[model samples]
Target: MKIAICCRKGSFSDYWLTYCEENGISYKKVDAYQSDIMKQIEDCDAFMWHFSHLDYKDKVFAKQLLYSIEASGKPVFPNFKTVWHFDDKLGQKYLFESIKAPLVTSYAFYTKQEALLWANKASFPKVFKLRGGAGSTNVKLVDTRKEAVSLISRAFSRGFSAYDPLASLKDRWRDYRSGKCPFFVLLKSFFRLFIVSSAIKLLPLEKGYVYFQDFIPNNDTDTRIVVIGDKIIGERRGVRNGDFRASGSHILLPDASKVDMRCVQLAYNVSQKLGLQIGVFDFVHDKDNPLLVEVSYGTDPDYTECEGYWNEKLQFTSAPINLPKMIIESFIQNSSN
Candidate 1:
């Protein structure tokens, strides 16, 4: 079967293409940006592109291309269900609620009056997040009503940038200071201060609505479990020093013991119920129980988690698993069947 792998340089597609070559699977590297992209895949049975949240151009058109292809009965890597809510926290909130999944309690307001009304009466220490972005880049803590009210005004006014330069700088410094990054990495941040990339500059501000979730306190880390077909991979991320957020806290190593087995089961069930083929669901807990924080199609460092995996039966397999291969092969398998 012929496949078209959207080749974003150095991305999962790189390995996907390599795997195809190594295994003698028929494939072609296609640039999804080309206007004739549809024509590019005419002879292909499937397409696999790992579209990201940062690219404005990508956010605007990646799914459009994929869904359009899907309408033609061609199989896509994310398919429809796997990526319907990618990079959209607001969409995820409702999907979880609709599915009766154990998502962290979240609220959103689209109107100035509505947001202000909620802000005035709502409790503080809520987790404020822009609908887009990964790595906790858009997530923050709203500790007071006044702070929340100000946020609402901006949400209705000019809005927030999906990329926050100051926040980015702070995160870089934090990572460096925490020994999470080397000295050269810190220099890169300084360079970034003056020379921001086109991707950041091109992204328009995020507005139209504001979303907040109850800040589940005492969570020093967040657990991420990735389910690829019937196989699952898990990891725990320790929060930054004195920080309650763990979603982007770069200090994580694969440790099966640190994960709550219940989370594994819940992830399996939720993904199954949603008809999801591949997903990475994040979880954080209060004192008593674990709460779902977020879900996404891909994690920035999903490859770093070359560790343990679990099958659908809750059986553990401590061998190395290549998730990117699984993701690509799943698309091909579905198409062939």
Candidate 2:
């Protein structure tokens, strides 16, 4: 079958193209941004595009485009089931609850009055997050009622920007101090303080709602398990120094021994129930039970590297594998059926 792939330089498309070339798979490169994208891929049996939440253009129409294409009965790597809640935490909250999945206790309120009422009654140290944002970008710990009220006010008033330049700079500086990044990278982040990103500028402010997750305490690290088709890979990410957020801390423990297979099995079962082709689930413990913190369909390809992967039966297989190749093969198999 002929396949159409939208190539983004550093995205999964690069590996996908390499796999196509090596395997002699019939494929055509098409740009998803083009107005005639559908016509371009009309002859192909499947389409694949690695759209990013941080991209201005993709945020506008990627999901709509993918939904339309899939509705037409042609296959896509990330279909509607896989990505309807891709970058939306609010959507995921409702979805997890509906499915009775082991999600952390969360609350969302659209009205200022409702949010204020809840804040007044809720316990301290709730985790506040903007519906959108990855890598702990818009996440904050609300330790007092006053802080929660202030956040509610901002959510109903001027609103929060999708990008926080000051926070970004601080994170970059921390990384540089820890020798995780170079000085040049830190310098660039400093300059970015004055100049806002075009993507963030084009996006409207996040307002009109507040989301909070009940803080589960005493966890120094969180587990990230990624399920691609039948394979599961996992790692533990340590929280930043003096911080509770671990998603972007970059302090990773790649030892498979540290990964809890129970989390892997939970992710696998949830993915199956959701009919997802790809899922990356982050888990924080509620005492002994693994409660899901968040879910996403995309992650950095570099982070997928592990000593091995687990099968559906929770059996570990020590082998080097290409994730992008696995994704394409799964798509092909699905399309053929």
Candidate 3:
């Protein structure tokens, strides 16, 4: 069987190509952006593309392409089950509610009046977020009714940009101060503030709706568990200093001892129930019970160093697992079957 991979530098494609070559697997590179992309992949039995949420081009047509191929009986790495809700917090809320998953309580309002009414009655200190954005980029803390009202007004008015330059600069500065990133990276962020990213320019503004989640206080860290096939790996991410967001904080603890097995079991069960080949679940605790904050099919592969992985039975095994390889192998196996 042959596979067609949409190659992108710095994405999972790099590892997938290496794995294919080393394993003597039949594969070819195809540009998902090409007008005749479907025709280009006609010779392959399966397709894989690590399409990213941050890419405007991918956001425009990646799902369309993948779902079309899937409907044609060609297995894809991230099938619809795994990616329909990706980078869409609003969609995730509905999906989790439908599936009865242990998701954090969230609210979404499409009208300004509705959002204002809810804000006035709802408790303060809620977590505000855009429908799309990863790594806490479009997230904020609404500490007062006034703040919520202001946000609501803006949501219905000028709306929020898909990319926040000031927030990006602040995040880069935080990383530089924390020694997580180089000074040059921080410098680039400053310049970014003056320039609009192509992705942001191409994407539409986020407006006409407001989303908020109940704040679960006293949590200094959150868990991120990635379920790829039967292998589960996780790490704890500490919230940034003076900030409530843990994702993209770059503080990762890969100790298996620190990982809660219940989260592993929950992620595994959730993946199984959703028929997902791969899922990255972010969990925060309310008391001792873990609630899913969000789910995605992609993450920074270099963000953590895992000691090992947990099997389907929640059994920890010391082994080095290549996530990209697992994704490709799963697609190949499914195609063969």
Q: lDDT per model, in order?
A: 0.84, 0.90, 0.89
Q: Candidate 2 at residue 162, lDDT?
A: 90
What TM-score would you give candidate 1 relative to the actual structure? 0.96
lDDT of 2 by residue, 1-337 (tens): 8889999989999999998999999999999999999999999988899899988899999999999999998898789999999989999999999999999999999999999999888999899999998999999988999999999999999999998889888888877887887899899899988887676799878999999999999899999998988888888989877788898888988799999888999999999999999999999999999999989988887755577889899999987756777788888877888
Weakest ten-residue segment in model 1 by summed lDDT:
298-307
- Give per-residue CA lDDT, model 3, range 28-73, as digits (tens): 9999999999899999988999999888888889998999999999
Ranking by lDDT: 2, 3, 1
**Could you estimate the TM-score for every candidate?**
0.96, 0.98, 0.98
Residue-by-residue lDDT tens digits, candidate 1, 1-337: 8888887765688778888999999998898999999899999888889887778888889888888898998888777898889988989999999988888899998898988888878888898999988888888898999889888899988999778877777887888888887878778777887888988888988888999999898877788888877888888888899677777677785788878888999999999998887889999887868889888886652455647788999898888667777787776666777
Q: Indicate which candidate wins on lDDT.
A: 2
- Judge candidate 3 against the unseen true structure and give its global Cα lDDT, from 0 to 1: 0.89
Question: Positional deviation of 83 in candidate 3, in angstroms?
Answer: 0.9
Q: Write down the worst ten-residue block by lDDT for model 3.
A: 299-308
Candidate 1 or 2, higher lDDT? Answer: 2
